[model samples]
Structure formats: C-alpha cells, structure tokens
Target: MAAAVVLAGLALRFQVPGAYRSPQPWRPEHVMGLVYPAVGAVVLRRRPRLVVAWLVWAIGLLAALQVVLQPLSRWAVAEGATGAAYLRWAAFWIYLLEFLPLITLLPLLYPGGRPPSRRWRPLLWLVCALIAVNVVFAALLPMRYTVGPLRVDNPVGVALVGELAAWRRPMEWLTVAAALGCLASLAVRFRSGGPVERRQIGWLGYVLVAVLLLGCLDMVVATPFALWIVPISLAVAGVPVAIAVAILRYRLYDIDLIVNRTLVYGALAAFTGALYFGLIGAVNLAVSGYGALAGLAGALVVGLTFQPLRLRLQRAVDRLFKVERDPYRLADRLSRTVQQARDPAAALTSALASTRQALGVGGAAVEIGDRDGGVRVHGDGDTADLPQEIPLRWHGATVGRLLLPPGRHDARLAGLLARHLADVAHAVRLTADLQASRERILSTREEERRRLRRDLHDGLGPTLAALALSLDAARLRLSTDPASVSESLASLRERMIATIGDIRELVYGLRPPALDNLGLEGALRALADDLPEPRVDVVVEDADVAGELPAAAEVAAYRIVQEALSNARRHADARQITVRLRRETHGLTLVVADDGVGLPMTADGRVPRAGVGLGSMRERAAELGGSCTIGPRPGGGTEVVARLPLSSARGAPAT
Candidate 1:
C-alpha cells in the first residue's frame, strides 16, 4: 500500500510527459504528498494496536499483489530462470496468506460482538496453524514457465500447484461468503448506533465489494486476455479510487453542491475547448487554398468562436457556484420539511427518513437532552439492537445524539447523517429559547401592571383621603371661632398642597403624562419645568419628532432625561442646566449639560461619577434599542446625551 501511494505521489510530482523516468522518482513533492494521509491517519493511531494490525494486513496484501506479479511479468519477458522465478513468486503468495486470518478477526477486535467464550483463542490459533500449513505446502511447490502441460516441469512439489488451483475454486466461494458476512456485520453495526465503527468498517466493505466486482469481471474477460493481468491491473485501480472516495469524503454530506459544480463546469470547459479547437483546425485546413488569407480567416473564426465559448463557460461556472436554496438539494428538502412540521415528532420523523435516504444509513433517530445530565430518545426509527443512547452535542455542550443502525452500504454514512442532525437540533433549541423568552416577557409585563395598580390603591389612596378630611374639618371650624379657624385653615392648606405634590409624583412615577401628551420635546420641557433648583435653560429646535414608537421606548426616553436631571441637581451643584431636544435623520436626540463641578475621575483609572441614576437611564435607553452616554463636558460641566429612535418617540403621548 505504501509503495503504491509512493508511486502515485511520484507520478503526480514528476508530471513527466513520458511514463517511466524523469526527476520524478526522487522529488520532494512525493514526500510531502505522503504527509497528509499519514497525519490524518493519526486518528487511528489512538488505538495503536488496531492500527498496527491493519497496517500489517495491508502490507501483506500489497506484497502479494505487487511483488509476485511485477517480478513474474519481468521474468516472463526475460525468459531466463523462468522456473525458479515462478517458484519464488509462488512462495511470496504463500507468505501473504498469513494475513487473511487478521481480516476475519478485525471486526471482532472492535468493541462490538458478544464477549467471546474461553475457547475463542484456541479456535483462532487453530485457524492460524492451518493457514501456516497451507503456506508451507505452497512454498515448496516447483514450476516451469514453458507451457507443455497444465502441470509444471519442475521437480519439488510442482504437482501441488494443480492441487492448490483446484482448491482455490471452492475457496473462491468461501471468500465470497466472507465478503457477504462483512457487509452484513457493518450494516448491523451501523444500525446499532456505532457510527465511528461503521465508518471504518464501511470503507473496508466498499473496497471488498469493488474487489469482488473486479474479480468477476476478470473471470469473464480472462478467457480472451490473461487472467493475472485483469486482477492485477483492475484490482490495483480499485484500491486508489476507493481510498480517494473515503479520504476526500466525496459526496458524503452537504459537499454535493461543490461536487455537482465541479462536474458540470469541468464538462462544459472540456466540451467548449474541444469544439473550439476542432473548428479552428477544420477551418485552417479548408482555407489553405487562400494561403495567407486563409490564416486571417481562421484567426477571425477562432476569435468569434472564443467569445461564445468563454461566455457560456463563465455563465455555467457562475450558476454552479452561486449560493442558492438548492445547494444540497436533499438536505434543503429535509430542512424545509422540518421547518414546516407541526410538532417535534413529525420533524424528527421527516428528518430521520430524509437523512437516511440522503446518506444511505441503515437507521436514524433524534436524541434530545434532558434538563438533568442525561439524554432521552426524542424521536427515531432505529432498529431494536442499536444502542439506546447517542452522544449529542451543540457547540462544546453535549445536547444529545442520534443513534443509527447498521447501514446497507458503508458505516461512514451514519456519521455523515448524525452531523447534519446535530445542526438541526441546535437550531430547534434556539427557536424554543426565543419562544420561552417572549412568554416570560408577557408574564412579567402583566405582573408589573398588577403591582403598579396595587401601589396606587394601597399607598396613595389613604393619604389623599386624610387630606380631604383635614380640609373638611377646617371648613366646619371657620364660622365657629375666628382664631381657632385661622390656625386650622393654615394647617389644612399646607397639608393639601403637600398631598397634591405627592399625588402628582406618584402619577408621574407610574408613567409620565408629559410623554403621553406631546412627544419627547414636550416631555423634556415638562421635566425641566418640574426641577426645583438650578435654573435650567431649555432649547427646542427642529423638534418635529413625530410618529408612533413602541410604548416601552417612550417611557425609556422620558425616564433617561428624568434620571439625568436628578443626577445633575444632586451632584453637579451647577448654577445652570441646559437641555436640548431635536430631531435627526434617524431618531430624536437629547443633550443635557450642567455647569457644575464635573464628575471626578477615580485614582484607579476609573470615572468616580456616581451612577446611581445613570445605570437605570442606560438600561432604559437600551430597552428602547437606543443608547445614552454621560461624560464631562468641554466647558467645566457634565453632559448627558441620548439618541432614541423616532419610531419609538411617536408612541409617547404628547406632553
């Protein structure tokens, strides 16, 4: 296997127009070419025992295929010591037979199959002993190249060749049985939720199937040609093709789009090139009578032909590579099916059936993660013998896994199917999360309204009632006693004013009426009017902030200004506060500045500004999908600037 790979690497690197020799034999490119598969094969290296076993088997098989055939062909042509050559090559084949037992044991070595009884090793040893005896018998055989009779002319055990040849006919049937067993085993394993095992087993199965076909083709073709030539050459071709299919993961999953484009565009290019070149040649031949004129005509023809060909090829290439809904047509169909499904069961059924068809897996199922650290079988149609649980994951977190039974073809098909299912699971989980969030938001909103109504009834109602009683008492006393009535009236008047202030504050707390009445400009003006200290300057320009915004947005903008003003009055100690409201192209903007001692910068490279109000203001602005910033002004003050969307501002009531 290594030699074949090395030769192939050399062939690619040499790019030698000729078949045999160029600097190709010793090129560094060949060495680098071997590096990729070797590095990739590191995954197998984790189980060094298994890897070494397979490596030994591959080596033995390759030796039988190449060493005996290549040298025998050369010796046949040389026609010297031909008898000795045949005998030596036959010995090499005998030594290679020892590798066959390994193939039978390979699947058993996997963590599958029932635990073997104690007699398993003895049976294995007995098989090995028989293989060794057969090898020794074949190695002792003698041969002669010149064909006078079917039996060779050499002395030592040449008759054994005839005996072995007869034996191979029945053994061929046994080999066929073994091959079928391998396919069945892989299919059963795949359906058993063993994707990784299936992938490796599947590759071997594909190669064996191809080998069987080639063998059959050789037997049919060998009557006319030579029997050895078909098996040696065609069988060799099968290995690399199968390996390429496995290594490149060709047509495994979503990469079918790339494969389709490559095929279509490549064929188009070849066809166009052939047509253009052929036409050019034919025109040149026909116009030769005109001599130099013919040359010009041919050139014109070439030029005219190229534009159409290039344009067609370019269009084909463009279409091939274009991003469209049908990139992986089968996968896309499955995605749409899942999207349109009414419930998880339907989605899983569609997904499993479609994925199994798309990937040719034996069985498939969706495993969902439970709240506890365990997984549950969500939906699937896997066979009874398959594993109950499959490892599922999203990102780095294990979500769940799909268990697929053994497939009809390769085990690798299961792995390919599982990967796509994992993505689908992640997307479904995200959709569920979004739905939960929306429900929570609705529930919280109702609860908040209930709490606000309760506060109004339980807190402000008594205060207002007491103030009304106090005024009534003052009215009753006024006509009875002049001095007493005057004292009662003064007390009543003070209490009534205070109560009114409290009621107004409470109403504003629930929701600002200014915002509801006249939009953001009116609301900011109202806020400025309500502030008790530090004469505030209000500037309103181009404040055509109109249109309805979300309810949440209106409250956010109003609250931001309220909080910023409160902070300025409490901390800035500024003599004057300037407030501005205006409309920009995208949204409404607000700027508040106070000419007070600016926010202090802390010693730890942080701003020491008290954010008692800023955090709530920022949160409010963010809730509206807007932004706010509070920082020191250039002219010895603090500036609070905010931008809220116009769509949100419109929903605020006019102040």
Candidate 2:
C-alpha cells in the first residue's frame, strides 16, 4: 500500500500541470527513495524482528507520502472537495516523520538491527518521548505549517499552544540530546564490537560522511549554481546501498583504508577551498578587480601542491590508527615493560596488558603453550570473545598464541607479539641450557676419570708387576743362567716401551697430542692436509692472533673445524674444502665450506635434521660463549660457521 501510494505521488509529481507545481516536482527529501523501502524489505526478509528495517520502511514510505499530499491537497481544493483543509493539515504533521526516525530510532538499531543491550532501553524511550512531545507541540502550536507550496493552519489546534511554547526551548534541547544519544550508541558499539560488527558500522559511517558532505555542498551551491537540492540529495540512496553492502558482506574488511583516504582528501578539499576564496577576496579588496587572476593563481598553486600535501596528510592520519608501522618503537616499549616486570611470569602478563592498551583492540590475551599444557592470560577489555588467534614461536617451536579481536591488522600484531615473546623468554631458556651443559660436562669428566683408572689398574699394573718379577729372576740367574737373563732383559725393555705408549694414549685422551705438538693453526692445517679425497686449504689472516688466542677458545675453534671437516669429508661428497679462520675483535670465526652436494634439505628448504657432528660443533662453540650455524653455502655447497669468544672460554692448558 505504501509503495503504490508513493509511486502514484511520484508519477503525479511529473504529470501535474506546471501552473500548480513548484519549479521542480521531484522529491528533494530523498532522491531515489525507492532504495530505502527495497533495502528495508531485504533486511526484513532476513531479520523479521529487527527494528531498523521497520524504521527504514516507515521513513521511506512517509517521505513519499509527504510528496504526494501537496499536489493532492491543491487538487482537492480545485475540485471543491469537502476535506481539502484536512488533507493540507495531514501534510503538516507528516513532515515530522521524515527526519525524526532517521536521526534517532534508526541509528539506535542500526547495523545490528537491535539495541546494543537492555541498559540502553531508557535512552530509547526518552528519544521516543521527545519525538512524541515535538509532534504534540507542533500539532497544538496554532500556526500554519508548509502544506504544498503554501502554509496551512492546523486542523486540531489546542488552546495549550501557549503553554507548550514556554516549554519549547527545553524540549528542543532534549530532542537534540536524544539524537546525540542514538549516535553515541552507534559509536559505543563500534569501539567494543568485533570484526564483523565493525565492518557493518563502517558502511553506515561511510554513507554518513558522504551524505553530510553532499548536504552541506547542496546548500552552498543552491543559489550560485542554481542546482536544486534534488541533485545532491541523490547521495541519500547511499544509505540503503551501504546497508545492503554491509548486511550482505560482499567484500573484505578494508574500511579503514577507505575511511582514512576519505578523511585526508576531505580535509584537503576544505583547506583548498578556504584558501581559494581567501585569495580571491584579498585580491578584490586590494585592487578593485582582477579577482579572476587571483583565483586562477590559487587554483594552480593548490593543484601543484595537492598531491604532495595529500601524501603528507595521509601519512599523518595513517599513524593515528596504524601504530604497528614503527616496529622499533613498539619493540623498545615492550622491552622496557618486560624488563621492569619482576619475574618470568610477570613479563608475559605485563606484555599482554601493554599490547592491549597499545592496539586499542576490544580485547586481547596471551596463551603460553598449547591448550592442554599451557596457561592463558587475558588483558583488560572485551576478551569474552576473541576470534583471531596468532601463534607465537621460539627457536622454530610454537611457544604459545596471541588471541586478539578479528581484524585485518591482526597478522601484523601476531608477528610483533611472537618476536617480543621470544626475546622475553630467551634468557630463561639460555640459563636452562647452560645448567644442562654444566651437568653434562661434569658427567663426561667423571667418565674420563673412570676409563683412565681402568686402563692403569687392569692392563698397565699387571705388565709392570710381571716386568719386576722377570728383573728379579734375571738378577738371581746372572751367574747361573746368563743367556736366559739376556732374553728376559730384552722382554723387559719391550714391556717398558709398551707402558710408555699406553701412558701417551691416556694423556692424548685428556688433550689431543696434535694440539700440544703443533699450535691451534697448525692443528687445523694438519686436519685439512689429511683429507686426501677433497683438496683442502687452511687460511688464517693473522697467524699471531691464532697463537695468542685463549687456550679454551683455540680448542673450541679447532674441534669445531675438525668436526666440520669430518662431516664434509664423510657425508658431503665434495671436490674442494676451505677452512678459513678470522680473528674478530673479541672472538675467533671459523668457517668450513665443502664444494659438495649442499646440505640435505626438507621439501620446504629447511635443514632436515641436526646430525651429532653439527650438534657437537654448536656445543663446542657455546661452551666458549659463541655460536655455530650450518647452512647451504652461497654457490653450491654446505658451510659450517662457528664463533668462539675469548671472554668466556672454558678453562684449558695454554700451549
């Protein structure tokens, strides 16, 4: 019924004679108003109980009815109809329906199609009361209101009109308050809402800005350009279009980018316009003409500077929303927060709280470990429901996950949080690793001691006792059996030489013989020279530095090189190998490269496994307060690089 009534009114608007019509008969209140009811119908089909769709339908139909009444009343008068006055009066009250619902009720139930919560019920009724008060006051005001192109007296005017006037100012303020309350409701939802909710609100926000700008522009250009409000009011259709787009969920949640650009360009336009007119006015004031030339110059200047100014403003506004652009600042701030925290547990908690505040997300939480084994910490906000989860990893293992609101920028937050968490936990892990390494070293020393004791007691002791017995026999039989004594003495001499070799083997087990015989550089050169299959070169830029290196560092560097060379020789099928040693400021860097089949990698280009040889190299370096990394070399081979720092070198005998 509303659609037919509105359709006839619009058709009659164009068909009515020019004499009875205003200059234009088209509806200026909402150009392309058919969209509103259509959108309302769409929303109603999806959500029958939603008040927003109902409000949209009411607003659209009534606006159309307002257009129809003017011509109907005028026609009724021409026809000498008995209720012509009544028709004109109806037009007066109906115009109230146009803006009241839109600014108040519709926005209150917008996007979500329901009140945010029961707490807002009072505000809803207050707005309703305000709307009712304005209507009653207007009806009883005892004045002619716009009915068609002329004023029409109220048909049901009451004597309380004077009394109502006394309260009108206060009521006006109350009505304005009600309208703002509805807008506040929308804003609150946006701040506390989830990703889907934000995207919905963004649509309304987009259309609101466009309509507002167009509305203001229409007023400015109305008289000067002779452009009717009808033309600019077409932006009103954007409301329904935005509604449909939002509710339907057609595209990505990229509203932030769009809205940011709009703000930048809008401000640019406003500034440029103000400058243009200011320049024109100044020129006209100075010289009694040539304002056109000043306007042209201003236009040219604005045009030339527009792009540069836009870029600057864009960056400025972008910073306001995207705080993740500066990683150093974020990292430094989190680093301080974690450092200030008293304990290991407190570090994660502090980081969570700080991140929540910084991101301005509705809610955030940090989960350490998996669901079954780990603990979860939540920050202050709407963390009741966090839809996005980003995992935090340390040393290629997932340590935990960060739970945040569903948003496009969540990925960036994930990466930042993961890195920060890893850094915070590293000290604890490193301490644990050091303690374990110390225990292993103690166990290895004890095992070495046991082996040495066994070698002497079981093997060397019996041989020496037998040699003593043989010597005694030789003494006793010197005169009686001199020939037999010579043979026995020769056997004793062989036994003594064998004992010396056994002692040397035990000493070598404690410290390599080559390390004692030759210097650290010489040991590395000997290892390379022994590898006959692959041609090897040992390089040390400063030979003196190698000799002067701390004993423990030298040992670590030599062992790392030895293990790397062995691995390359046995596993890496290579034609050439290079052992390069550099004396760094506080440490030694050893790099062993083999021109062989590069390191075997997994399908994803990662090292498949850590071999014992590789692990040994890393342990040796770590014992000397340094690091070792093995990876595929630049051109076509595997390289094992280790650093051995002199400051924390494990205690070893100096050469």
What's model 2's overall lDDT?
Answer: 0.72
Could you tell me how far off, in angstroms, the CA of residue 393 lies in candidate 1 after the best superposition?
30
lDDT tens per residue, model 1, 1-655: 4446556434443332332223213322233223323432542454344443344334344443443343343334344444645543553444345345434443333323321334355544544455565565555545443321222433455565666776755654654455344445545655664444445445545545546666577677644444444454544343333333433433332233334455556666666566656655776777655555645655576567666766666556546644222326656677798889886556767787776555443456676653212334554433454453445566777666776554343344445556567776766654453453445445656777887777667866777777778777777777776678777778777877777787787678778887789876777777788888988887877635545556665687677777878888988898999888777766767788989998887666446533436655654555455667788899799998888765533354322
Model 2 lDDT-worst window of ten: 369-378
TM-scores of the models, in the given order?
0.42, 0.51
CA deviation > 4 Å runs, candidate 2: 1-24, 28-32, 37-98, 110-119, 128-177, 184-226, 240-542, 545-548, 580-586, 601-635, 647-655
Please give the lDDT score at residue 336 for candidate 2.
93
The lDDT values for all models are 0.56, 0.72
